[model samples]
Target: MKRDAKNLTNAAALAVFWLAGLTTVVVLGAVIGYVLVNGVGEIGLEFIFTNPHGVNAEGGIWPTIVATLYVTGLAMLIVTPVAVLAAVYLAEYAVQGRLVRTIRFAADTLASVPSIVMGLFGLALFVESMGFGFSVISGALALSFLMLPIVMRTTEEAIRAVPKYIRWGSYGLGASKWQTVSRVVLPAAASRIITGIILSAGRAVGETAVVIFTMGTMINLPVLPTDPGRSMTVHLYQLAMEGINMPAAFGTALLLMAMVLAFNLSARWLLRRNRRMQG
Candidate 1:
């Protein structure tokens, strides 16, 4: 009777798991299908290449597209090295004590802070305090702040996932601590580290509040990092909220989705290639 009860419970759990997974898949498929169906008709070379006239009513999202790329690229450039190094220190070198615990707690706390709050902080620190005055650099810095905690946590977890035996073997081979970490462990954890970076990139791309607070709503191509600009997300919000152009907003949304999808797919393909080569 006990064995039969256990079997029934297991079956019930398996059914629940399948139901949850199917629900998630169905919801995601529905969203993507809706966006594509609504926006595909508006996507064209001219729509993509031309500059917007009067708040995205007459032309393409060329300027906002460029600004989005600029902000995301700059944020990644600033955050990647710092987060990776911090993760390495925490995972490989830090002593297990109050300092490490505090740092970890801080990262978790920062990760949970709302993006709107981060935008406010960015406005105060980067725009007002630093006198950056609504520019690409200010927006990028804000995004870096938003992405840093996520990247750091993921990288630390990835680094910790590397087997201790690998480190011991490297030490046995007379490799220094730095050598073992950089040459052996980091390589082993490269895939996960890249995945973290991809996640950070996605967040940077989609962020609206922080970008608006720092970057401003200048719907023009930025010639320099100091130039005020609008990203795709910012443009989409402006279009939808201000009732300027809904069709163009949908088109921009589709483009943003496509860009993110392309990036993820490309990164995955590269990771697979690297793994096959390593194998």
Candidate 2:
């Protein structure tokens, strides 16, 4: 009787897990399919590859695309090194105690802060106080803050997940601590680190409020880091909300989605290649 009861409970738990996973897939599929259907028609050489025209800015999304790339690229570049170093220090060097706990707690709290709140903070610190004005640099600084905690946390986890036997082998080979970390551990964790970066970038690329608050809505190609520019998310929001161009809005959103999906797929491919090579 007890055996039969255990089997029944296990079956029920399995069913619930399967149902939850299926629901997630269905919802994501539906959203992606709907966006592709609505915006696929507007994607073309001219629409994607040209710049805005006239006072109302009706043309292509070239400037916004450029701006989006600038912000995402710059933000990632700014945070990736520091995040890796910080994670390495915490995970590999630091003795676990109150200080490590406090550091982790601070990062977790920063990560939980709302993006809009971060935007406001950026507006005051970078845009106003620092006199950077509304530009790619200001937006990138704000977005970097958002990405740092996530990247650092993931990197630490990845480093910790490395097999202890591997570390032991490195020590047996007479490698110094720094040499072991730089040559073996970091290389091992590289795939996971890249994955974290890609995930943070995916979220940052579509950040509208931060862009609007820090980077001005200038519908032109950003020639310099200090030049004010508009991102694709802000463009989509204005087009949809202001009723300037609904179709363009859909197209812009679709393109943003596609860019993210493509990057994710590419990252997966790279990871697979690395794994196969290692094998």
Candidate 3:
């Protein structure tokens, strides 16, 4: 009787688990379908490529898209080298000691800080002290702060994912530690590392709070650095907050999602190609 009771309980738990899983799938599918249908319903080629002009809910988002690309590009440029180096040092050369622990703690703290706080820091440092005056550079730097932790964490994981035997084999070949890391281990982990960086790019592109405080809220397609660039995220935030431009805001959101999807898909394709070539 006890054995039979246990079997019944086990079967009940399995049924509940299956039901919960199906519920999750249904909820996610409904949300995604709703957004895609409403958001993609009114977008046209001209709306995407033309610059936003009047503020009376008749503007395009091309300038916003351009600004998003510029700021995200600048952030990636600043983040990639530093994040990769930090990951390399931590994975290949760091002696597991107090210093390593401190660094790890610091990284964790930075990662946990809110995006709005990072924006405030940028407002203080870049906008006030550096005299950047809310330009794309300032916004990019703000985004860099937000992205650095993600890039470093992901890159560290990628580097650590490399097989131990690969490092041993390189050492057996009389390669120096740096050579093994730079030429062998990193190359092996390149696809994953690049994927992490691209993921950070997507985050940077979609960010709103940080850019709003640091990048200023100008709508013109400014000429980068010297002038303010209005990112798509900022535009969406404004539109959504204004409460009367829901359709346009949804459309902008859809475009942003499409951009992120395109980037992720392209990155995956490239990674696959690289893996095939390596194999």
lDDT, candidates in the order shown: 0.91, 0.92, 0.87
TM-score of 2: 0.90
Query: How would you encode candidate 2's per-residue C-alpha lDDT over 96-117 as one tens digit per residue?
Result: 9999999999999999999999
TM-score of 1: 0.89
How much is the lDDT of residue 222 in candidate 3?
68
- For candidate 1, write residues 67-186 as lDDT tens digits: 999989999999999999999999999998999999999999998899999999999999999999899999999999999999999999989988899899999999999999999999
Q: What TM-score would every model get versus the actual structure?
A: 0.89, 0.90, 0.90
> Which pairs clash in the backbone of model 3?
none
Q: Best lDDT goes to which candidate?
A: 2
Q: Candidate 2 — number of clashing residue pairs?
A: 0
